[model samples]
Target: MKTLLMGTAVLAVTASTAFAAGHSVVRLGTEGAYPPYNYLDDAGEVAGFERELGDELCARAEMTCEWVTNDWDSIIPNLVSGNYDAIIAGMSITDEREEVVDFTQNYTPPSPSAYVAMSEDADIAGGVIAAQTGTIQAAHVAESGATLLEYPTPDETIAAVMSGEADAVMADKDFLIPLVEENSGMVFVGDDVPLGGGIGMAFRESDPEMREAFDSAIQTMKDDGTLNEMIVKWLGEDSPRF
Candidate 1:
């Protein structure tokens, strides 16, 4: 009976260790409003480049990942609070953000962010440009002579330009390219100043192990053509720095 009890205790310890090792779920967060990065599809499902990329990364890492959506402004704070493990939003690796959270190596390369005007005759060469609120692009627009009108989302920015409420809307090159292609009246006059290198996954400074895992997964995706394929699918062949 003593030997049997000892054997049962050993088995229980082994089972507990296995359970701990198997708990490999990583919670990823994103702003569901950003298209080509992450967005809600017509079917109300989370879909977009970042969503696909996250799914692929989790698969490669042999871990389960759960995606949660939140307002763009709240993403970083939520990450800091441990509400999620990482942010796959198209958030740029800016110096200001670096003060708050650690970022993985950029998966997407640096691309010019620009303003597009809805009016063919709108002279944006020396006019006002608008950008989404609280973004690096907004800072760039403010520097220009154009008065910056900050919106909460890209859709609002686009609407402002479309309705003549704003002279132009500023956003990433890849994001504006598709909008220009689809809308005949809109034109991308010139490239705005480059903001930063590129968008990266962000993690809290406290979670070094999670950050390392995410960085490793992103590098693997980049080396194996996964990242390139995703870029092409979402941003087209002319996408900068594919």
Candidate 2:
């Protein structure tokens, strides 16, 4: 997941010293690009499912939180560098990622990836494909017969398809479905590609206590049916339940 320049970038909690000291306020980081997960509204404030869920999680944990937005490419590295206390981005739990950062238990279960193309007949297998860099979809495209075009942001991946740079884009279905429904030119093509584990909050390995706090809060949401209600409210009534 960390594809950027990696040097002596030790996981220091300097950026979140207050949180490390068990302060009441913790800074939460996110990409603010993926829709229905984390994104900035017209007011430039964080708003989405993860935002609502994260706020509730913090409230349940009896802590105050502030939102920090970072690029998808550097989201993890910034977290490892202690740019924030935890990553509330829609990050998947993968072994490769686990090697660099510890993850709270998944809040959302594994979701399927899908290909969005200009037409239903587009060549998804042998044509060029676009995906955000450092993502599971990018790795999948790298291995597939189709040529892979990596973008720093999720919007660029979609733009690549719209501008004829790529035949299709591969990403989480939840992120693509809305775009497909809104655009007459774009439509879901090919079969679904199951990629990555569920979405989870990421924290420094040295901050297990913070991770546990959020983890327990998430479990409480699940036990009390609040999580599913939020999911259905933001995602859809048919969204997966706990």
Candidate 3:
């Protein structure tokens, strides 16, 4: 009877351990350069809409969370290799990406994408716009017959525009509006274009539970005032949301 009781206790302990392992902490990755989405503030702390939303999701799911900053181009590859448990970098959910990793329900709806010229003299609507290679915006630029100066990240493309190296940059309207506002010479030209769909949290294809938790948290935030508050904070009053 004593041996049997010890055996049962061991099995219970093992079960508990397995359960704990199954619900391990989730690590979220982002490119710390895209403002209003994920970026380092003046104090060098990661703070933005995506960062705040990610924290909220982790809290709602009752999961320990850690944020990892990496280059934009490496985010998806790292996620595939298990370097990070998820990606929250304003990543658009498109069919091309679905071929590799699965995405949670879109938290941010699709907003129009646009181009901003750094110089008033620069004809953005007729000239080339710099875009990050392998992004949906790049594909749109390609379709427009405008020369696409491909870069590794949005920061690089923005830098090129600021330096007068590129005539303009094609990106989400929210990102460009703030940038153009801060730079007097910069202005968004041309009508906004629909790139694809909304931005969603991405996770490994096998992690259905984690994906579900994030999706539920995103929906909860959207239903409550949290998402609206964030949009107002980052995008200001006249911001568009679709």
Candidate 4:
């Protein structure tokens, strides 16, 4: 799970300059707290699956790009507000989100959302369940039989479960995997659920050309199998791919 801890001051300067056709400049916004997708590494730089994938897509699209870190809760609103050129975060494609922002073709397959608790004995059927607010996972929790507890960030959802404020937390399986592996106190339980279509880049509704550019670049990578290789490298062998 990822949390937002810093201000957007440095990220505000990412899209300050613009370039022409052969040297187009684009700013990519990401939540640098979700591991294997986009997260701040030990060097305090954005690193992981989306970082590698976004760089390759930029090269193929002939765009000079830079990364910008943002909190997950406000990521979409900031994109629509012109804070960045496109969102390269692992944003799932949904009709609700698509109504506000256009999305490129999916680069990653649909991901399975999972649940985990501090102990296997923890109640997951009808007890308090935690999830990040504004996400599809949170919506699902609200509709499920369990009592839903919303948090501003993904990290806080897990924190709630660990601190006994919540019985379990639901989130992307890829996100909970590494965390569960490292902490013996945590264990994944219950059947996994799939939500949304797949992960894609988001752009302002007026920027259809930007979406098409990235869509074409993603298609090129898929055709040559580069996309699949990178998916395995960062998301583990069992992760679904293009």
Candidate 5:
């Protein structure tokens, strides 16, 4: 997960207004930085697992959708303020978050968080750890014995480890796997930590109908096996499904 301020302000539109009649335009918000989940393509448009999955869900729900990018930290706040309809970012479903926004049935199963360091000998439990701010990994580190260093972006969390500002970086195993493979200096350390329930789309509390529509669309994908195919395609064949 990551956060960055959008260059322009988006017109506020509630799900009730935008998604009227279960077949109207609904703006989908995401952090265009988390790869294999959501990220910006070379064309500067949002791409990755979320983009393809969101588009399919929109079509299945008979709704027109537009993508919007928002800072991850302010994503929930902006959703509450009506800047967008639903958040399709790789957001974890948690009681703490549900108290503020409503979540659809989970699209992805629970993922494990892992640590990456320059050496296998790194002290994953007691050493300083870097994590993207506002993410479940960050919360886990804050509670763990390790010193927690928070960053605004996933890249920065990796940077903190590369620069030795922190002994290791903690993030979703899916996100860290490719990075670890590409970087000769980085290696996974510590046991994989499972946190949060699963990933889901988030809507305002007042938009129960809108949430239900997408939830049904998600279930359709699961039933047809399309969701699992997509998950394996982007998140590796070993990724948890359903």
Candidate 6:
């Protein structure tokens, strides 16, 4: 459920040349599909929480920045290959990913992963469960007793359940809450599973300076309570704070 994607566009802001002299433009890559986090608005421009946060962080760091959209599957690889300077997608900071790229301090805390189904009695533990591929939720299902049905996008996983191909779907609780409320038939089932450490921006292993700049900006937001406020504003009142 923690998957989504969309097209690319660039938005740049002029910054203080005194603070950013000689610094290259920092490109922040996102999926531009996941709502309340990163998504493309009607204008085909990247919008939502991460967009605002990324912009603020760049401003604070005195870096001119641009937003880039890429498929979720290639977000990280693109960053490493210089397609982008950092990844601001809703990517969790996991040990496995750390082996490939460095991560800044978490911007959002880990939220519980839950199951949604047509019936509350769906066999979440042993039935077919759909999850977006390459996500922590998919990894969880592979290790759970249930059969894992993988999809490339979150919409497809929801479609799998609607078509009766899967007994249930597991995804971030925050992402599913709005969907379950909108659909009368879908209901939550089984226990809520917490996955990943939290969400963070990623940079290639060689970009320690970029990583540290963003990390410091994130910490400043945390200390001032703005990060927590943004978390609640987009994720809901029950979402965990920094």
User: Candidate 2's residue-wise lDDT over 15-127, tens digit each?
Assistant: 34555676888889998999989899999999999999999999999999999999988988788776788998889899999998999999988888999999789898899
Which lDDT tens digits does candidate 1 get at residues 148-188? 78888889999988888888888887778778889899897
Q: Please give the ranking of all candidate structures by lDDT, highest first, separated by commas.
A: 5, 2, 4, 6, 3, 1
RMSD of model 5 against the true structure: 4.7
- C-alpha TM-score for every candidate: 0.86, 0.92, 0.86, 0.90, 0.93, 0.89
State model 1's lDDT: 0.79
Higher-lDDT candidate among 2 and 6? 2
lDDT of model 6 at position 184: 97
lDDT of 4: 0.87
Assess each prediction's global lDDT (C-alpha) against the native.
0.79, 0.87, 0.80, 0.87, 0.90, 0.85
Locate the minimum summed-lDDT window of 10 residues in model 5: 1-10
Q: Between 1 and 2, whose lDDT is larger?
A: 2
RMSD of 2: 3.4
Better of 2 and 5 by lDDT: 5
Best TM-score among the predictions, by candidate number: 5
In model 5, where do residues sit more than 4 Å from their true spots? 1-14, 21-23
Best by lDDT: 5
- Over 23-78, each residue of candidate 5 has an lDDT whose tens digit, in order, gives 48888999999998999999999999999999999999988889999989899998
Deviation in Å, model 3, residue 159 alpha carbon: 2.5
Question: Cα deviation of 180 in candidate 2 (Å)?
Answer: 0.8
Tell me the tens digit of each residue's lDDT in model 3 across 70-109.
Answer: 8887788777666667899989999999998899988777
Which lDDT tens digits does candidate 6 get at residues 1-242? 22221221121112223223457578889999778788899999999889999998998888878999998887877776667788998898899999988999999998888999999889998999999888999999999889999988788899999999999999888888888989999999988898999999998776677788999999999999999988898889998887
